[model samples]
Every structure is written in structure tokens, then in C-alpha cells.
Target: MTPVWKKTPKPTELIDRVTQAFRLAFGYEPTAVYSAPGRVNLLGEHIDYSGGTVLPFALPQRTYLAVTPRQDRLLRAVTAQGDAGASASSSPREIELGAIAPGAVEGWLAYVAGVPWAMAQEGLVSRDELPGADIAIDSSVPLGAGLSSSAALECSTALAFDAFAAANTGREPLSASDTGRTQLAIACIRAENEIAGANTGGMDQSISLRAHQGSVLAIDCRDFSTRPLTVDVDRAGLALLVMDTRAHHNLSDGQYAKRRAACDFTADTLGLTTLRDYFESTPTLAEAHQLVARWEEQVTAGMVDLPPQTDLPTARAALRHALTEIARVEECLALFSTAETTEQTWAQLGDLLNASHDSLRDDYRVSCDELDLAVNAARAAGALGARMTGGGFGGSAIALVSQELVPTVAEAVASAYERAGFNHPEFLLASPAASAAQDR
Candidate 1:
């Protein structure tokens, strides 16, 4: 049977594998093994940076870390073959932890080293205060699948090292600290930005660190606050089909930054700190759009300098995508809150998703041919709705379909990809990605 990256099989089959890899890499057993899940953004894309809201849930697919705390401050890292955080290899490779520094560690382990480096820089722990450890990793989360494999890898390493630090000094678990998950998420963001060199909007880190079991987190980018919403995905006999188009996206490229710059330019031109701020002040979308139009008039009249590196069209589209995606989150909530959600209700939810994709694809211009193909194929296979998720130059598209049609939709997508002569893609059903328990 295939091993899933979810919170199943109690002690975790991946942890067992990671433990064996740890022993094989070093010479003894690990201190503790920990894991963290990746996530799928159900609604809202590229909106988090504009201080808009997003709905996302952690996936069962996750990343893992097995570590042994050391009195000697030597950081030795190894990863199992086929691990999410490392290159595919026939044997493990080790990196000394002492060599780690911000903007230094590259490849898959940069994200791992970044956690401790970030924490130390923040003075949460001094450089010498951090104990050296032998760390080994294994994961089922597929890298570059637009499923937040980076966040999962970072969080798992963060929690593992945090727990180890606590054990050595006898302090409350990091989760019990007043700082809690938010602080961890921030640290992960720092690592991703400053270390991993991925300038992201923080939705991935927040959901991976803060999402609850069996729930989607509604995150307000305004203040990084989150609310858990229990989605009855199974109640409607529906499944979220994740289609990894294998069209990997490198968000560090100019495209992701270009879109973000446009959003920021729009907000600045409108005299607001963020697009969310403008919408918050305006009572309705029409009024906000009207106000934005006025601002564009000012720019055209040379009454104010237009924000740099963005045209009026791109700026307008960015703001529109941000506002509409936030609205979709509310629509999804209302649909799920009805007295009795039926298949038809799900179809309505699907329509909202379709509208979201149209906006992202047409207005935001994030969807590429492969992503469009995945969405079209899933819809052709009878998906209630389908859309591309993640940073979106190309990564993955998600489809909402009845549980029974999962295979059919998946097969259809695969066949379509083959017909297009693209690489064969991977697919999986949606499941809430939960954090691991201490005892379990």
C-alpha cells in the first residue's frame, strides 16, 4: 500500500522510515521525530500580499524530520532517498549544521537551516544556545506541486528543533507559549524570504503552522488572524481532486513579483496601505471600484505619480482579483452554513470556484496553458468546478467532484495531458492535513 502524508497510522509510517534513515545516516537512534502538513488554497490566490483574505486547509501529505540533539554544536543533516526536501539520490547526503547561515544554505536544506538561523537572529535563541543535532528527513509531500511542500518542510523542521530546545532547558512546549503558532509562522516566513529566497505572502506558512485538524483556515492578511471552518466535504459525497500538472513554478521568478508589485502600486496610488484597506473603507465593491477609477483619473491627469513598474490595467486587475477572491471566501462559508447542504448546494459552491478561476485567469493572468488544460479536463470529466491553485504561473489545478468520480476525473486529466504531449501528472484526493500529536 502507498503511504500517505496525513495524520494516520498513529505513530506515522514516514516517521518510522525517517527514524531508520536517521540511524543509517548517523550511528544511533533519534531524539524525536516530528512532521508538518502541506496545504491547498481552496480560495483566494495572490491576494494575501494585498492584505486580502484566503481559505486554505492543510493536506494529509506532509514532510518529516527525525533529529537527535547533540552537546557538540555540530549540525549534520541527511535526507532519505526521494525525500521532499532533497534531490533524488541513491543514498543520503549530509551537511554540517555549523556551516549554516542566512542566504548561505541552498538547495533543499536551505529551508531547514533557515529555521534555526532565523530564530537565532531574532534572539529567541542565541547562536550558542542552539544545540547541534543530527537531522534526517523523509516526506510524502511532492515538491513543487503547489501543495506547500516548502512550508511543510520548514514547519516540520521548526517544530522538531523547537521541541528539542524545550526539552533541553525544561520549558513549556512552543505551542503552549504565548507566542504560539503565529510567531512560528512568522519565523517560517522570515526563513522563506531571507534564507530560502522565496518572497511569499505568508498564507502557506500560516496555514501549515496554524491550521486545525479537519478544518480550513480563513486567514485575514490584515492582521494574520485566522478562523477555523469545518467543511463537510464528505457530507456532500464530494472530493477535492488535486491535479499536480507537474508544470513546476518557481515563484522567485519575475512573474510573481510583477503581480505583487502591481497590487502594491494600486494600493499606494489609491492612498491606502493595502487593497484590503480600500475595500474595508468602502461599503461595496462598486463604490471601491468607483474610487479606484477616480484614482486612475488622478494618475492620468498627472495629479499624482502612478506607482512604478505597473500599468493602469495590471494595477486595476490586481485589485479586482484581491477583492473578488475575498468575496468568494464568504460565499463558500454561506454555502456550507445552510440548513441542509445538498449536491445542488455543492454545485453552487463549484460555480463560485469557477468564477474565481475566470477572474484569476482572465483578470489576474496567472493561469497558463497547462493549468487551463487541467481545469478544463476536470470540468469535462464532470467536476462541479475546477481552478488552478497556488502561485500559479504553473503548478496544480484543483477540481471539486463527487467522491465516486474522483478516478474518472483524475484519469481524464491524465489522458488530456498525454494527448497534449505534456509530462504525465500526479493526482490525489483532498484530506485535511493535521499536525502530529505528542504521544501518537
Candidate 2:
């Protein structure tokens, strides 16, 4: 059987439903409703925290938060659930604004309450001036699918706080200017890292806040600077298909933290600020191989300081993946700089995607069995290239296929999963989507 396909909800309907839910939960009208898109990283994986560049575009599926500032410093929040087969509805939680802090809130609620705390702690707003809010969230972004669902929630909350700050403090809206959006993105990052305890990098928040329709954002992780590249695959008869493996993936778990630690250890031992710095110096695939060989020699000679639980091989693999992934992003950027793309241009891009997945699976050790199966199956079914696109313990894979072959590719993946006795996957055709903004 062909797997199920998900569709993006109409924005007006989503806004209306969430607004009604907000009125029922808080007994008042919301000041405004804001939304942010989840993102799919087209290329570059597991290299953001290493200060490497990445390319990602926004997903139409979004999280909508209807919020209103309260007169007093108390946060009341609720969410609509059970559509994805979880709880029917989340129990409303009330939190004192003063009590907001890192690790103070737990479960999914931290993603909401931590925004105000992060904004104040990061100096985006004053703690005394911060307003308490009542939020009701309804999202279509699949949770734990490696689709940046948590970032979507945090970014939408960030926009809500910015709107209130603009009204109360006489400051301009942060989402109105690129500079302001960057600041908002930083606050969201802090919320995820400190308040939510995810230990993730800034890619998801950056793309969610800074992306533009009909384009992908190329983010320089070192400075978080971005440039939009218009890659119109539809004109070339290609479609980007997202394959949700239905395998559980959670970044807040310790597994993600360990990988970040390994990357940091590799940087410290190599005497570089980050692996990206080294990539800048040695920017070719050949140079990356040579550098890895030299590092292996040093490890064997007992000249490198190895962390207790991390060995030379793991560190070497992590460094290699970061450096090579950076180079692939550079190549992809160069390809997009052309005035028009051809079949050959896409073939080259496809080659890079295939290589990226191989590196993540073999070198970074992130891809799981389900992810591997989906990617391989898609490629076998005439996909130009396919790769796992998220945090990768078990998440979604992306396939680049001709528009006409989409159904064929989807069926092939479904058959593969059934033969393996894995959960049937879901599918979506991802298009470039807008950044976070007030919907009402």
C-alpha cells in the first residue's frame, strides 16, 4: 500500500481554529496570532554547531500561537492535541513570570514559557518590562520528525513577545526588520538551548525567522548571516519529497548532547576555534583527507589529548564530516549562482546530496536503520538523490525526484518499509515557504 500523504492546512482555517481555542482556554480575545514554519535542510547536516554554512528552506506546515499580554505576571498556556494520536488536549498550566528560568519549566510547556525568559535574559527585553501571556497552540508540523517542530513553537512565541514589546515599550516590531528578526532568532536559540535544554545550534531558528518565499536561505553559522538563493526546481520538473519514516527522534535526549560534545572536543584538540575555521583554511576535499590523515598520525603518537569516553576515531569522523559538509554547501551555493539551471546542474546537486547522507551515516554516525532504508529505497526508485534531513537518530528523509516519478518513488519506499516490517511512512511535497509573522 502507498503511505499516507499530509497536506498543509489553510492559513485562515488554522488561524480561526487556534483563535477560538485561545478564547475558550483564556476566556478573552488574543492580541494577535503569530506563526512560524518548520524547515527542511537541503544540504549540510550536523555542522551548524561547528560553525559551518548550511542551506535550508521553510516548510508550509507551521505552529500557530494565539497570544495576549496579561496585566499581571502570570503565564497561562494550553494546546490542542490528539490529532496525531497523543493526548486529546494538553492540561492548561499557569506559571508565574518571575518563576521562569532554565530548567524551571518542563515537558512541552517549556517551549512556550521559556521565550519570555530568554528574551529578558538575552537583553532583548527587560524582566520588569516583560509581559505575561496566555497562549493557545495548534500545529501541523509533525512532532519528533526532525522537522524543527520545537523551533517552530519557540519562534512563533518569540514573535508574539516581540509584538507585545513593541506595543508596550514604544519599540518597533522585531519581525519588521532583518536586524530585528536576527535578534529574535537569537532569543529563540537561547530558549531552545537554555530553557528547553536541547543543546542545538541556530540553523532552525535562523531559517524559521529569516527565510523568504520561493528561496532557500544560505546561513553562515559563524555570524548567522544569510543570503537567499532562488532554486526553482518545479520549473525543472523536479519535486522535493519529504518522507517521514515514523521513527521516533528526540534532540533533547542525551544522544544529541554527546555528539555536540564530541565536535567541541575535536575542535579543542585541533587548536581551532571550530571545524569551520579549519575548513576555511583547507577548502578542498583533498585537503580534508590530508588533514584527517595527519590527525590520525597525531592520535597514534599520543600527542593529542583524548577525552575519557571519546576516542580518536570518533573525533576524527566528526571533524571530517563537518569539513566535507562545509565544502559541499559551498559547491551547492556556486551551482545556484548560475543564471539558469539545467539537468546537469541538478545532477551535480544530487551527487552532493548523496555524498552528504553517506557522510552522516558513516562518518557522523547519526542516521538510523529506518532512515537508511528510506533513502536507499528512494534512490533505487529513480530519485536523483535522497538523504535523511533532521537530527537523524530516526526522522525524515528527503528525495529529489522528477515530478512524474513522485508516485513511483513513494510507492517503492512504502513497499520497502513493509518488507522490512517497519512502520509505514508518510509523505509531503515541500515548497519554499514564508518566515514567521503575525497572522492576524
Candidate 3:
């Protein structure tokens, strides 16, 4: 919709920086550089672990890695962070290949070390035959803003190591085939969950590996199936704006984990295995709604006993958001799959986005005041719709705006932040970008 971003810089820009950093840190030029893009979840938040639908788009911003194979069982990993990233508690160091276990590393380095640990566990590469790597990382994706920068780093790490594995095993280097990419994404998920201790569903890694330029991925979190639906918002005079609130979020902090656990508890209360089971087990949305409505009423009546880490109010809230968001996903996908898009179509989608924000704020209880202010300001400035994206507690928000209003709306948001005495948040203009680098 945005003319395929003719002036966007190639991954080569970051590749050059990562290569130089790799050389400086490891005393050798790395064999090759690989990168992966961060993503902004447009809708269907928090329902990922329920095996519900999630819509996400890749950002032009990305994380990059330059890797060299080591003959010995040692990995030298480092990152050249900007002044902003200097607060990271972990420093550059070498870790034994066998010692790359869960909780073996701390802070951001844990996410990096986790990928190879997952690869080995999955038998994608043999521990004995694996060539440990020296890697240097660099990223433009903003960290801890609910934008999925961790997935970007894990994906690039997977891509780089996959190539090294191919060379070691006499297999061809990693290709961009859908199946191969999906498997790699799962590996990345394992890294985040098992090693990095993020405990998330696989939506972030799936989007990182499966995103396409000018499209949004409608992912079925159950089986990791995805359909790339065209998001020609610009053709209808609309644009997608990511407003980074600069209020950091950490998924490992137990609240996110608590939400996932609550969803599971709701599913169990509904006599189903997962939240998406409503669609698979019931014949109609009305029937399913009736089922959860009973539980909701019970929850409201204080008849149900919720876990100590959660409460009846929280469980009721989780169930309400999950059922409604799943229906919204189906409706949004149906409209998006239409042959041609019009102004009316974009308007309907905008309404869905706004509804999504409301649910995330009130039902999911994840939106913070900073995120709320950004969305409200964007809408006040003529955005069609605005909503908090990602895991929500103090993160970023996305707005659907007409292209002509982008500058004016952006200015209004900054002015509001200034007037409120909050830091002027980082504004990112995003359409879709390609999922992975070109086939190697």
C-alpha cells in the first residue's frame, strides 16, 4: 500500500554494522550475516496461548547477527548496543556449548544463548557435531516496548546457526520454504520458553519467520498455520502507525505468565482443553457464547473457585476477552479475504481495531495510562482507530490513520505527551516487510 517502501534501507545496512562488530569482538570477519524483523500485533492480543487467532505485521526494524563457526565447544557472543542499550547487566563472554542450559546465562544474553540450546534439543543439529559459534548482534527494533524484539533476535540467531548447521552436516544452507521456516520458528519459540524463560505462545516467532511485505499474518496459534492477508490500508488512504510508549514490559515478570495460566484455567472451567476449543467443539458462536456465559455468570456470582495466583474476577475477565477476540479474528479475516478493499472495508477494520483496544484495556487489564493516552490522542487527531498492541502492560499502541493525516496526527500525539510532561514517545511508521531474508 505504501509503494513497497522504495526508499527503505536494506538489511545490508545492519549487516555491515553486525559484521564490523563481529570482527572487532571475535578478531575475525564472520562467515555471513543474517537478520529477522520485529513485529507489531495488529489485533487478537493475549489469546495466543488459547490457540486463538493473532494478526501481526513485520516491521522494517530488525535484529541482525554475524556468526563464525568455532571448531571447539565454545561460543563467543557479544552485542554492540547503542547508548540506550548500555544498561544491560550481562557483558560479552564465552560460554561452553554444553553449558548453554536454561538459567545458565542472565539478562539479554540468555535469549541469545537459548536458540542454540533449543536447536540441539530438537536435533536440528547434533551436540557432538555442532560447530559452536561466535556471534555479534545489533538491532534497530526497540526493546521491551511490546514490539517482539526478543523474537527478532532469536530468529536471526536461528537463521545464522541453521546455515552453520547445514554446512557442518553437508546439507544445503537454510532456504525460505514455508515448512522449514515454520520449524525454525518453533525452535525459536522453544528458545524463548525453555531457555529465556519468557513462557510465551509461538505467535512472535511465527510472525518473524512468516511475515510478508504489504500483508498481515492471520495466524492460528493452535497449529501455527497462517494466511497472509493483504492489508492495502494505504490504497484506501490509510496508514499504520506504531506509537512506542517507552514504558518497558518484561514477559518473564510473572504477570504475563499469570495471564496464560488464567486462560488455561478458564478453558478447564469450560470443560475444554483450550480457549479455541469453543470453535472446534461447538456448532455455533451463539452456543459457545452460552457455554462461557454460564461460567461468566458463575464467576460473577462467586460460585467458582479460581487459583490463588488468579481470582474469579481475573478468570471471568480472561474468558470474556478470549471469546470475543476469537470471534473478532474470524470476522476480521473474512473481511480481509475479500477480493477488493474499499474505504468502507478499511473503516470496518478500524472499528475492529478500536474494539480490540477496549477489550485489551478493560477485560484483559493490560493497558497502562501511557498506552491509553497515546491511543486516545491518536483517535482525537483523526486516526480511524487506535489500540494497544503486544502484551500490553506498558508497551506500544498501533493506530490506523489516513495517509494525509499521518503528519498531523503524529504531531498531535507528541504535543499531548509534551503537555502531559511525559517523554515524547518514539513514533514508527510501519507497513509490512518481508518475513525472512532472501533465499540463501
Candidate 4:
């Protein structure tokens, strides 16, 4: 299957408008317009922050930006979807870009402003940097849907800026080597982490920059190394259906922060810097569980500090659960890459999905009533496997089903939800999609 990078509609429009705005503002059209996709974790929820492995595939949804260099130090940015006044017109909103410090702009603008600021800080751009030019940002990825929409925005902006720099330096057709897509991606991720203050891992930006269609990205968060597992999901007569709960998930929520704190405390208790270290040294669930149990003793005994009344048992359970879930993520990748028959692949995939949900629910303590209800309904309606997919407080769930049963499955789940006095959920039939890329 071709990755979703080619299918993003809003980014495509945004690219065109930004290119036009740059031409108007700088008297020269951009050499290239680029886009990067938001991703959905096929498996491995909360593991990214835990410094474990993650398997994320780029969605068809993405953010697009277009840009060009300028002769002056001002940066102008406009979004086709932003609050552009009648006078402002869909043209670029002129801003004194080089004058603003790292944390000058707040809210969504930080992602835009921070990119250039970070690049300047990294010495990638000199004081005489291509000043700044007009940029237009647009995206179709659902925000706060646990799909990495913010990553898409950050990456697209960074890519556009990098492309402009390369073009200005007389570098034609900016390649990965010339533009340093990896470095730019990391910069965007840091912008989110440091400037934006969201404690998310770099998985989104990494996948956005490095993912390939017909594959799953196996990311080792500790060192940022990656391997692309070529997965074939075509023969199973099955589709991965994503249902949006329409519930917003904030990464800075206390629950999320608490879990991360607990992981850190556990790692420290074991004389490790990250849970990844513990996993690497101890390869079995039993060994990991023993280590976590000891870590819990320290938290309970006040030897190790807890994150303000965090349940020791709950935290320990979460840590152990993360260990098992990481193992399953690896297994799912193997199954996807090597399964002989579609039925067998679906069966294996479904089992892993169900197992993953159980871990999230019982051990990780992230699942909610709404998510549980959806999973139950899908199972009752004959879904091969169904579970909440993301950070799980109120995002969406994925159901693996035979193509013939999709409608029945969706209706059953939606009806069950309505009967429980909830809003009718939106169900999307999704498949493994490709990573984001620039439009030709």
C-alpha cells in the first residue's frame, strides 16, 4: 500500500498557498514544498516516553508547508485555516522573525517560531541567515486525537525552512544529506519538548521523517536508532479500522506526568537511567518484574520519592506492564512481516491487540469506561480484535475486522455507545499507511 503521505488533502492546499505567499513576499517561488505525516501507534502506547521501543506508522493525514528565502531578516507566516482578517488576506502575516527569542510566541505559534529559533541556536543558520520568508502551514491530521498532529506541524515547518536554506545556498534538489532531515526532525522534536513544554518523546517526529510505506518503523528511543520492518498486510481480507472518540487528550495531564515520573523513579531505583536500560539488561518478563517489585518497595518505603501520592502498586504494575507490552510490540512486527496467510495474520494481530488492551487496562491503568465499552462492543459484534490504541484516557480504538463485517461492526459499536448515553462515534476504515513526504 502506498503510504498516506500522497493522500493528505489539506497539506496539499497549504503547500500551494504558502508557495504563492512566498512568491508574493520574496519575488521568487519556493523550490519545493514539503509535508510530514502524523502517525498512529499500531502498538506500543506510552512506551515512547518510557524509553522503550515503539512501532508507529505514518497516517494518510499530514501537515503541509511551502516556503522561500528572503533578503531581509523578517519571517512571515500565514495559515489558510488561521484567523486571517480581510486586510491580511490569505497572504503571509509579516512578523519580525529574527528579532523574537526562543520562547517569544506561545500556543501553536511556538511550533512555528521555535523551529527557526532552534535552527539559529544550533548554528545551522548564521546571523546573516536567509532572514526569514513567508511560510504557510496546513494539516488534515486530527488534533489531540493521539495521532501526532503537532509533530506533523513542527516537522513540515522545519522541512520547509531547511529546504529554503539549501536552495539559497545554491544546493539544488535538497537531499537527506544536504538538508539533514534527521537533524531537522530532532530540532522540531526539541522545540516541542523544551519550548512547547510537552514531555512527549521523539517518536512522532522520527516517524514523520523516516517512515516508509509497506513497513513499520521499529524505533529504539534510547539511542534514536531505527529499523524498518517490511510488513505485508494485504492478504488478510482485513482492514485496521480507527474510531475517533472525539475526546481530547492532553499530554501534560497529571495522570500522564505521574506515569512518566514513576517510570523515572523506577529506573533510578534500579540504577538505570531509563526503563530501556532495564529491559536491555534483563530480557525476560520475570526478571523485569522482580526488578520492578524491588523498585516499588523503595517507593513505598519512602527511600525513593513518589510523584505525590502515586499508588506504589499501581506504578509498579504500570512498569511491569510496559515491559510486557514492549515484548508484544516486537512480536506484532514479526507477525506482520512474516505471516503466511491473511487469516493467520489477522488472527495473530487480533490476539496481540486484545492482549495490548488488557495490559493498558489492568496494568497501565490508562483505559476508561468509554474505551472498555467500545472494546467490549466490538468483541460482542464479532470483531477479531479491538482495543483502545493511544494514550487511552479518551482517544480512539482500533478494530481488526474482515472487510465484509465492517459496517455491522461499526454500527454495533456505535449503537452500543449511544444506548449508553454517549455521542455516536466516528469510525474510519484505515490500513497501514506510508510516512509523510514532499509533494512533487
Candidate that scores best on lDDT: 2
Best by TM-score: 2
Q: What is the lDDT of candidate 1?
A: 0.76
- Better by lDDT, candidate 4 or 3: 3
List the pairs of residues colliding in candidate 3: none
> What tens digits encode model 3's per-residue C-alpha lDDT throughout 1-440?
12111133456677787777887777777887778899999888888899888999898888888887888878878886632466422345778878988888777777778888898888777876577788888888888778898999899888877877887778865444788888888889999988888889989999998887888998988888888888777777788988888888888888888888878876776577778886754223465467567776776787665655676676666777888788777778878777798778888888988988898889888898889999999999999999999987887898999999987888787777787887668787887887756321
RMSD after CA superposition, every candidate: 3.4, 1.6, 3.6, 4.6
Writing each residue's lDDT as its tens digit, candidate 2 over 156-182 gives: 999988888888888788889999899
Query: C-alpha displacement of 397 in model 2, angstroms?
Result: 0.4
Q: Can you write out model 4's per-residue Cα lDDT over 1-440, one digit (the tens) per residue?
A: 11111133554465666566556655666656777787777777878766778887788777777665567777767664453111324455565766556456655666777777776677665555445766666666766666777788888777667666666675642226423666776777778766665767778888887787767788877777788765455455676777766566666556766777777766776677777676655245466667677767776688876544666667667887878777777677667555465666668778888988988999988887778887888888888888887667887788878788877778887787778876567766555565556774
- Clash list (residue pairs), candidate 4: 3-434, 4-60, 4-434, 236-342
TM-score quality measure for candidate 3 = 0.92
lDDT string, candidate 1, 1-440, tens digits:
11122223334677788788888878799878778888999988888888877889988777788888888866777765343334544444444556666667676767888888777666566566578778887777777778888888888877866776677778766655425667777778888888887878889988887878888888888789887877778877898988888887877667877777777776776678877777554234465467567767887898766557667787666666777776676667766664577767788879978988888999899988899998998999899999999988788889999999887888888888888988787877887767533311
Candidate 3 has its poorest 10 consecutive residues by lDDT at: 1-10
TM-score, each model?
0.90, 0.97, 0.92, 0.84
C-alpha lDDT of residue 69 in model 3: 82
Please give the range of 10 consecutive residues that has the lowest summed lDDT in model 1: 1-10
- The order by descending lDDT is 2, 3, 1, 4
Q: Candidate 3, 398: how far from true, in Å? A: 0.6
Each model's C-alpha lDDT? 0.76, 0.88, 0.80, 0.70
Candidate 2 deviant stretches above 4 angstroms: 82-85, 280-282
